[model samples]
Target: MSQYGKLMLDRYPEKMILPESSVIMASDGTVLRRIPLPETGYRIKAGLGEMPQLLIDTFIAVEDRRFYSHKGLDYQGIARALVNNTVRMGVSEGGSSITQQLARGLYLNRGQNLLRKLNEASIALTLEKQLSKDEILQLYLNQIYMGQGQYGVKSAAERYFGITDMKHLEIGQIATLAAIPKGPSIYNPVDNLELSAGRRDLVLRIMQQHKLITTEQMRAAMKGPYIPPVKDKTEIVGASYMDAAIKEAMRQTGLSRKELCAGGYTLVTGMNIEAQRAMERAFSQEEAFPPDGKNQRAEAAMVIMDQRNGEVAALLGGRNPSTGGLNRAVTPSRQPGSALKPIIDYGPALESGKYTPDSLLPDIKTTYGSYSPANLNGVYRGQVSMRVALQQSINAPAVWLLKQVGVSYARGFAVRLGMELAAEDNHLAIALGGLHSGVSPLMMAQAYTVFANGGILNKAYLVRSIRNSQNQVVYSHVAAPQQAISVRTAADMTAMLRQAVSEGTGRRARMDVTVAGKTGTTQLDLPGVPGKANRDLWFVGYTPRWTAAVWMGFDHSDPDNYMTAGSGFAAAMFSKVLSML
Candidate 1:
């Protein structure tokens, strides 16, 4: 029994999760996104419908030559495998017939022993009787484990070529797939090109030996560049960001890992690839903001939203997605400092019908109960309009506006705008971005969508559609934009934002297009530094075409590393990326 178990274990093929059902393409079939499968084990039934004759023939020729004659185990092949593996010392050693391979794959463990081998034969024989020949072949195709956490031919195809249909396989492609079952690592095309080519030629030679292909076809298959499509190259840019997104996706989709992997769910996401690449380009420029030696690091996070779609176009959770994996974008709930003023004070003021783009407010030094808010200059500007107050990010004027708008009413308005304002009833200090738990840039982007889309808010999505291994539609995503504000009111606020960008505190953000945005800075409220500028800076803005938010701060508080609010380093990074975009 022990010896049999050992043999079964030695021959058992590794099992892995079935391929996930996901189709990442635009509504027009232009692929834009792809979700990978989870790591698990599953029976192969994904690609039985469209598998080509050549694929089946190749599997038979390489896996089990006497498949028709054998009951369940090919004794001759087993004898040959035992002799070759024991005597011939090359890495391409051992041969298990298709039935024996299937036996080990399905019923036995991966240990080498006679008892397990005998058990595998028994199960193989049983499987042959219980399942049809075609069904057995299908099961074998799906059950066999390919290296790299892949199982089944369908998954292997998609994992490697980013496609599903088996009929698509060329002769060279068939040879490559054929080569994997024999010592997957030795013939791993990604790792060793020469070994992979040699194995492929060997498979082609085997095909010719079995008369499965013409001599000319065999010759052509061996000549060169058996290059299959690139597969399994997951571009993990901010491993932290991807992890965060996956967690959120899983939570929102409500799909189990198996369902996510095999159900072919198309997750429509709000991520914008162009904006993401732009952010990557900005941060990856080492010469712009090099670290202070090794200890002092430079990192950044930015979020771009489409005002019309309310979809998150791009999000950079960290300065370097590869090494620095912390997702600063979606995870961090950093205080917006003066950035919160617009949501609490300005947005509410606009909604109340008591304020206009030209509404006047005071930026003078003033105390509201226990709290006193000051401007970045720490001085007083006697009288300023609401537009000037917002542009300068004056603390006192925002507080006064918050008070005039009624704290409770303002808080309610902020919620309507999507700011998740922590204040139960808006405190005057809420205008200064004072809250217990702050908001993420993602949420902030969602809030700003009100001003961009003439008041309609669309849910964000990253995936477009999902299809099963058989190319059957499993899930589809359709965007539904909701009305959050009136077009007139949103346009009125946009006019003020335009001034904030063109002639006010956000003048540094001046660009070619009609750019409108806000700047925010927070004082480091630490001992002996009540008014010291924090390392944090922000410039969240939008144009008719795009809306984006950029934030910059030190990993640690270094006063010298700090920028002057919207005019700081973060603003520069935002500008650099926006220019490229």
Candidate 2:
């Protein structure tokens, strides 16, 4: 190799350059996802020619006073910085010209060492020779980080000020953000109000000293209250949910994460932005679970589906969808309690050709060996129709009806409805939601969706479609509904469930819209806390438009925690969200 080539090879290691692909948008042409790449994180490109003159002038005034005259290095400014640092006795107290700053940000780490400084100077000089000053400055601006996870000025302006066009920012706002790159954390107006105001004043002082701003203008700017706007910080922002859905789709579809993030394509999803916002508003504003430390947090999960097509409309893994740890809506595996009774008892009876909505079942006190079941109120009303039994969720009558029908047959019926019931000797408890294996809220929502769709079961999907840079559809969730039950049985079940919403334990969940639902509460497994109570409390419900499940109970092994009867808390949130819809 040539001597210069050897030196160059030894100095900077070769790294592959990957160009970012444009983000794929939804069918509505809304950007939903993109291929993931480090360089592609929230970046948008615009040529230097398209940039506003005011923006360019702002950069020139704040970044490089001698930018137009200097080749790259501003020796006078460097010498002044050295002198200033020597006097101030602080690191980063000296001057770095715009070119040097850009070189360090784009080509080298901002380390306070001699090697990095040398490299920065070499690269800055090299870049000055190769590219026009405007081009270099535009690239620098595009790549630089402006606090708040905003990588570019455009992103920063939108995030902090909600302005889109570059020309919208006032001179003072531009100066404030221009000063922020020096120390983002300390000077962040949102984080440290006083420090940010002080730094803004300092920038104004610098501008005045350079005669960029009049003394009178500086005085006027200083008089204003530097109150920063409050960031919403709510977890359910559009960008946040879309980002998650894209990641989840990537995981489920086994697509390249990079392509999904940076490769621009159209991504259609099952999400309804309006419904999601409404659901988020309902959840964030209300207490959805019990407040006692045992069940202090009102964790809930909601899954909405398109009844006709079986697409997942909205899925909230928890009351706060942003909760980082557990996603109950998608993953919580808890016993359905009485909520399981519909599949275990009613479904089989419907399939057996022996039961109809009007069929009467003896509502007498019932027993299986030592297990004697009672109504929720500890009393029974004898000789009720099947519709009344299901609507009231009467325990003894359901147990008797299940016994008359048979558990193994009921298990098979539930399986047809998409519930994977673990093998167990089905007994009276099956009528009361006793299950060998637990089910997730998503699973429950899906199972209920069968009834909502008049026996058709469609696979739940979050993504609608994904397209590549060429706009060719690479992946799409096609709607395919399966016939799981006869239409007659489904309609009957819906009618009974609707009655449950109107007059039974799920009355708390009644909404202005037609709704159907069930309520469940198991004895706390803890001995003393509730004196032989079980561990799960639940309310699973659906409207003409949406389906949601709420589970409350202590995950603690000892279980001696306070219990939240699922009816009040979960039902309240459900009702609130339904009202908004």
Tens digit per residue, CA lDDT, model 2, 1-581 = 12332343246533112234445443344444433346535644445564566566666777788987997788888888778877877556436777777767665676876566666677777667766888777777766677765566765666566666767666566667777787877776766767877888888877778777789888887777754556556443344345556676687668776656655445677777666666677667645566545435535566666666766666666654542446666664677778877777776787688999899888887668988877767777779998888877778878887888887777777777777776673566768876666777667777787788788878676677766645587777766778988998888888888898898778888877888887776665544565544466677778876776666665543453546354556667667766776
Off by over 4 Å in 2: 1-50, 57-100, 122-136, 147-149, 167-247, 252-306, 309-322, 351-354, 359-385, 394-418, 421-431, 462-478, 525-532, 557-559, 562-573
Model 2 has an lDDT value of: 0.68
Q: TM-score for all predictions? A: 0.83, 0.69
User: Residue by residue across 109-145, what tens digits does model 1's lDDT show?
Assistant: 7776666656766666666665677777877787777
lDDT against the true structure, per candidate, is: 0.67, 0.68
Candidate 1 steric clashes = 32
After superposing candidate 1 on the true structure, give the runs of residues whose Cα lies further than 4 Å from its correct spot. Answer: 1-49, 75-95, 106-108, 146-173, 188-202, 219-245, 257-270, 287-294, 322-324, 423-426, 468-475, 555-567
Worst 10 residues of 2 by lDDT: 13-22
